[model samples]
Target: MKLKVTGQNRGFSILVLVAACLLLLSACSSGGNGSNGAATSSQQSVANDATSGGSANEGAQSSEPVDIIWWHAMGGEMGRAVDDLVEQFNSSQEGVRVEAVFQGSYDELLNKMKASFGSNAVPAMVQMNEVSSRYMIDSGEIEPVQTFIDQEGYDLDKLEPNITGYYTFDGQLYAMPFNTSNPLLYYNKDMFAAAGLDPESPPQTFEEVYEAAKTLTKDSQTGIAIAISPWFTEQLFANQGALLVNNGNGREAPATESLLASEAGMKIMTWWKQMIDEKVALNLGRKTADTKKAFVAGQVGMIIDSTAGLKGIVDSVGNQFEVGTGFLPRPADGAPGGVVVGGGSLYILKDATAEQQQAAWEFMKFLAEPEQQAYWHIQTGYFPVTPLAYELDSVQQNMAEFPQFQTAVDQLHATTLNPATQGAVMGVFADARESVANAIEQVLTGAMEPEEALQKAAEEIQAQLERYNMTNG
Candidate 1:
């Protein structure tokens, strides 16, 4: 394994950074309509063993209530839900008092954390995007939730395997998975019917999607509104059973290079370029918000977006059209792949007191409970990380009313676990996503051919990989 998260000592140097990438920024998550993850377990030692027997690790039993600061970056309805959860946790417990602080966006929060590293200003727990897994692992500022899991005897089985799989590394889980989401192919059912296509069936293959888009396109109305985002590209690569990086998606070992110029990448790039060239799809640049508005206004027939955006989009569309959700389109003749889990996870920071760490872990467990998970799933469009949440009345009722929200969960359940689906992890994911989006934009704008664009993107990402590894190596 490339990393280790073990030992009973509270705060040990798990990783040594050759250089600081503290100024490096990243976010691909919920509220942002996010990014899931995995990590390893090997012990240097277990000198100060903590909790046992499947209970909260109440960190040396403090005399005074432990005060812990939690930094999060969820805004609007999702932000309210987080505040509610935090309040519930705080009032429900007597030993720990949590002050939940809103930390702007993920990028801003990350930058703050980096800037505050090794300082007293860092919070006890932070909500981080899935893409930050590799960076977090290398930072040495986190206490692997695996430590708590080992001490508490937590049953991993009750949780969704796909989600756990993403966070589990070398038999150890890193961060506690929270607020999970995945991309979906959202189509206007009414538009489908008007176009003489079955409203119940959205296109399942790239070729089929193209044909459907072509048929749906008429004058100013395009079949789909596409935003040049790397999330969709990553989903497409997985959908076609391919990897975006080497070294088992930077698992098994740290990623040394990018695979953006591979056949899977080319196929997606070619398809994207072809759609624009044929005028069946509208390129709305890098902002998904723009494409989402176009779709909500019924200007576009279909779109691919995060499940986290489901409730807002549906509510916005209102009676204009019946919204339908479908699994992400794949290569018609290629091997079927799956979508990667997007969104953020809660991490226990090392700068915090042991009491604070224990409190944070307890809070994590509280959020993962079926009751809380169900409430969260409904409050935000993000699906529960645990399967038990699905059996609750809340989830069932919500699904019945807004059936479009069920597609992402259904799509996730049907996914076959593999490296492709587990997705990529890198310290420079923010820059990488931009590179991919820029490449697609260049192709669409005729600034460069698809082949040239992908090659340049690949090289740029490869450079990022080398820099990160060299700095953090």
Candidate 2:
């Protein structure tokens, strides 16, 4: 049977390598800070010994809690929220103890996973980035959450489909959606009104965005500032119902090609380049932080960024000017599409024993409960993956106060479910994103035309795909 939810209401606010990882977990566990750190072998032995050396009733009575390490990438305030959740789970029941260890950025964490693969010291649970799914699935080191869902007859109907869609591959759910977010068009209403544009009508298409930028460009303020990353390019493609990879975005089978040179891709690159040339759009380098700073400082009229930054941005903007939010700009003439989710999910590892695996599943289910999801959204800006969280009083109050929050949820629900929107999954996705970013830069700097740049990117990605499929085959 599942443990009951034990989270309390608060004021509307609320991995290491094998050897290196061992040191970190020992320190965390020793402190007894309730984060119960890594699953050290000695710790595992204690639990095992507790159940083995006594009478059946005595063994049952002396049942030691299963300890599981949760490797994560969230840091700063988000990292603290993670710690709080771990403590809550540790206190909620005696079945499992979760120790969450911050292991740097998503890329860094992925690198660490690669380094620790054969050591048998990998964590029992990991909060992996969305794009890392392809590689993780190929690694054969994870136990699909689908296994638990089927074993326990877990009903997935209560979870948000938009968030779950991205992790569902081969008719199986690979991970538990957590801390999900999407992109949003955030514009300064004051800037819009000053430009003689209707504040209520933010740009809805690329052309409209360009025109708005042109009108908003004057003095020190530009019309829009977007960090040129492959993510935005992917969003533009998905918004128009275009696939980034073949074979149903690798869901039907492992993808063999990247469609970065498709017509839709060309249009996106061309428009992005056109904006940079026209001087209305600010070509901030691939740091959304720089772009956000510009927007908050009132130097840019509009910007596009992850909904995960929604609360921070709004709070930073503070009473300086009103903020308006809209769906990520889509092509006016293209088929209906929607933005993809942009956060990590909790994954259970096969390195864990059966008991530890089930314990980890319980923790996953606890986090997905409506109350816990609402608390997560309240404590951090991450949108909830459980739709029922929206009905909670705290989340509703938050949405009412910051309608931009609602705009994000609405955009997600409004999206049409399709392979493109679910997004592309390829083993070298991280490398491919960098290649696409470089291709965009090449076009923006006039070193290559849109077609040539995208073609080059596609070729690089396809070549990598061939190698990855062969190696992992």
Candidate 3:
């Protein structure tokens, strides 16, 4: 389901920096945002990591070179890509050096961050996810980036809100989007054609999805498979006007508030239950590979997954089936919401020296450049965070070669500021989402009626929200 965003007034003109062309610079800083020593220290740590890099630079500053450490979750080629970028930056600069370290997956990074904080051994810079922003910001462990942007004299307007929002708390911005991605509908053209469905025209609406699923379901096949997590299902419910939380901030607003138990939510769960009962959809395990495998093996007609999964799908499917990309589907007449974004951001850790913070800001602005952004877009299936990145020659050239990349960009134009799309603002969001997922499982497995299951989930969420509010809000 497409989570819609209500389009705000476009008063700020988007500066299109065409790479292989020109670059622009502007200055800004954190305005009207509260600050704490812990948060500043966190931000400094992030800055320190980027500035110190891999090793101590052999320079003439303070008679010795300083070093900063970075802890990140990126691995394999992607991890290498990050290290290479750091290497390039370090080689290009002469002051402080930056070091890149690969820790593990998302969960591991979180654990490490918590442990380091307890030990007062936090790294200089940390790679953080969107959902974790609230925790870091509230913990007073992260520093706002707007100050860094201002000091660096970089154009704030050059970055997009979708990219900026990941790091924003209250009225201030903390982190910067490093690798953000949106979910897209992936289908096997061969399967569609074999099922007598139009390979070119995908199901754009939930009704169409149902029809297509029925037509695509086989004796040994599941027509559609979406992750059992709220990540995927939230999009569907968001598209249908069911909010997972009260505020439009994606569980980042008030812990005291709750909204998941609305009538819209009930309707959404009912539909899911009906889909499972009638065998039109398959409730696959949340294993990422399993979803892709089902699609590649032709066991499922449609898979709603990340655009980042495109390469895996292409590789797995090979020439066995035709692969097609489409936007996330929505209901026919609800407030059209776009999809929730997923990805990580770069946060400056507090406690870094001024020089390191300056150096880190330089690297961030460097990454924001159109050329760097285009390179990232090509290497990964993620959409470029800036509008100008789309206008870059590299991006344009890439779209010419591979058209599927356009779907993600086109969704940006369709974005609206709906509660569903903007996301929830609550404490313990991760835990609350797990509860929601458990409720979904119960419905999918026929352990409970969808309405009852979701209502129960809402009540539980409300209870949690109240507890969190008492403590955090």
Go through the candidates in order and give the C-alpha RMSD of each one to the true structure.
13.8, 12.4, 16.3
Q: What is the per-residue lDDT of model 3 for residues 1-473, given as tens digits with 9 covering 90 to 100?
A: 96343355232222222421333222112311232222233334334444444334332223223466778888886787787778876776554467888889877898888877734467777887667766777676666787776654656788877556545656577887778787888888888898888899988876788789888887998788877867776666656656666655444456454555666666567656667788988888767678888888888989888877666577677788778888888766655677666778887776555545455566666677777778777777766777788888888888876676677777755667555665555657777788788888887887988777777877887888777667765
Cα shift from native, residue 23, model 1 (Å): 48
Q: Could you tell me which 10 consecutive residues in candidate 3 have the lowest summed lDDT?
A: 24-33
Q: How does each model score on lDDT?
A: 0.83, 0.85, 0.70
**Candidate 2 structure quality by residue, lDDT tens digits, 180-248:** 888899999998998899999888998899899999999888888899878888888899999999998
**Runs in model 3 with CA error above 4 Å?**
1-66, 118-120, 247-253
User: Candidate 2 overall Cα lDDT vs. reference?
Assistant: 0.85
Lowest summed lDDT over 10 consecutive residues: which window, candidate 2? 53-62
lDDT of 3: 0.70
Per-candidate clashes, comma-separated: 10, 0, 56
In model 1, the clashing pairs are 29-34, 35-342, 35-343, 37-166, 37-167, 38-166, 38-167, 39-168, 39-169, 40-169
Candidate 1: regions farther than 4 A off:
1-63
Candidates 2 and 3, the one with greater lDDT: 2
Q: What's the C-alpha lDDT at position 11 in model 3?
A: 26
How many clashing residue pairs, candidate 2? 0
